[model samples]
Target: MAVVNRRGAQRIRNGHPWVFRSDLERAPAVAAGFVRVEEYTGAPLGFALWSPQSEISLRHVSADASRAPDAAWWHEQLRTAIARRAPLATESNAYRLVHGEGDGLPSLVVDRYGDALVVQLLSAGVNAWTETIVASLQELTGCTGILARNDPAARDREGLPREVRLLHGDVPRVIEVVEHGVRYLAAPWDGQKTGAFLDQRENRVLIGSLARGRALDCFAYHGSFALHLADRAEHVTAVDISAPALARVHEHAQRNGLTNIEPVEGDAFDVLRAWYREGRRFDTIVVDPPAFAKNRNAIEGALRGYKDINLQAMRLLAPGGLLFTASCSFHLSRGLFFEMLQEASADSGRRFALRAITGQPLDHPELITVPETGYLKGALLEAMG
Candidate 1:
């Protein structure tokens, strides 16, 4: 085993859980699948996924080097991951069991919506164990089907071949899963990342409670937040760039016999600006745009984008109405997000009352040291008179 430098070993020892190329003592000619990370003194540190391209460089599989990244280990991890969700009896049917590195299983995610499992093999290490992982998921969860949503972009980053196929069981074109008493048609085979945003389950329920009068869901992909508002609010206008996503939302609403949802297909910023210009006011507005900042460099531009949309949303909100805004950019800190919101309120000349500040569901557990893990942050506030 080639030795990893002192700094990398120290970082792993301190529980940061990733080693970069700069931290290596000597380069080992190991395959992309897995390699042993050791200290300069030849002391074994952990097993890591060796990525030559990404700065993440090495994703630690396990601190214990003895544990091989194979079928037996995967079966055990899959069993333990499923067992961890025993408390969520109803939620188990449609939830994320293994959240990549969050569950100590780096570069792999398993989300079960009813009897179907959506898997994302994000790294060479996980991809190597794909067959075993799929089999274990089926045997452990009794899932009727397993769909590999291995999008090409993520695989290319890992220097692995992109593959999308039904590894095991039966996955239909669209699978139905009930979430908080509402049935959601998840298209794992043909839909977005893992068929649905199961991570936002709890947040959507919270949005349902906050909905009132007319609501606007900007970048409301598939209407998870918008559709939830249908039963709670007077009406909902869902805006997204993807016409197909809007169509899916419309389809979901129609399936549920809901008629109060208005699927609007257009750029969120333009639509918000037009609504503001037309003096079209909403009682509640949710600006849950996709990640604007992927890295530190784009943060300034992303912040400006966030501020502009929020400023417009606040301006179009009626007095005492709500503004539920969020940024999924891990690069954007909670303090910075709050500061942006305050500035947006100031720019809009509106007094804002902070009702609640929330984050991703419990499934997406955030380690204190891993601040990047706690990227999903949002505020539920009311525009005061």
Candidate 2:
């Protein structure tokens, strides 16, 4: 059994599933797996995944104080998470089936891309059940193949080796997917976070629906946003720091038969600054950069970066134009994100209307109780000046 201090008990009671190493009074003797969680006085709290080696010692799995979660219980949780995402079959073939703590299956992430499934066991406790998880997924998804994208640094902290191997069936190097009628390719073998940023699916749809006039997609990695904007916008400028990524953008645009997309190679910050100084304006602009803050220590600088790019984007926004800015940094809180945009608006000296506050798609469920489950947030702003 794993024992926790008073503070840890209170944290679990408050709906937080993480019990830090500092809060853990005693961990289970086993190397890894589920264990009974108890308070200092031996009062049963729940069942949690006991990862003795990681900084997060206990990850709460079930609140059933009486029953320990067995293999059947975990199977049901996986099934429930999969069933919750059933409605998305019609909208797109690519989506997140299991969102770790968001789905009450902590430290386990399963993303589906077309015929393949990409899984990440982020914690030692979850890693122990990799076989069970893969077996259940093969039965549940009936997909062509399952690949383990377990190369995340988090595994290093958990005392697990990093690897990207085919777990079951046959997964291809490249998988094509469609989201809201926009088709794109996913490199499940060697691509960004489960091949693509599935969390931004809804945001892409929202921006595409309202795209018009000259649009600019800053930090357009593989041109996901640019592809959507080109469908409705008169012209589109897809900017990226890497010329190779821009090359992929050109290929994506060409494959989609979108001739209006122009790939621009440059840093988004420098380009935005140059555009505003040159009196260059766009009717629509999307500033979806890579996570500026990966940890708490970087939050201060990340906010500055966010504010600066947003401020420049606001200046380049024509009257009655749209600006869709987003941040994927979990370290940057949603409240802080809104506050940063407000500060940017004040600095821009422009009247901005908050058309919509965007968030993750239906597939990427963000629980209110667990802030870590959610990271993607954005705003659809209109320049009213």
Best by TM-score: 2
lDDT scores of the candidates, listed in order? 0.82, 0.92
Tens digits of per-residue lDDT, candidate 2, 13-46, equal 9998999999988878887989999999889998
The per-prediction CA RMSD against the true structure, in angstroms, equals 2.1, 1.2
Backbone clashes under 3 angstroms, per model: 1, 0
Q: List the residue pairs that clash in candidate 1.
A: 5-25
Instruction: Provide the lDDT at 303 for model 1.
Output: 92
Q: Can you write out model 1's per-residue Cα lDDT over 1-385, one digit (the tens) per residue?
A: 5467888888888777778778877766765667778888888887877766655677776888787577787788778877877766665368888887777787788888777888898877567677778778878988888888888587887777777798887888887878777766887876767887776777778878878999999998888888778878999999999998898889889878899999999998898898888999999888888889988999999999999999999999999898888888999999989999999989888799999988888677777766756789988988888
* Candidate 2 residue-pair clash tally: 0
Worst 10 residues of 2 by lDDT: 66-75
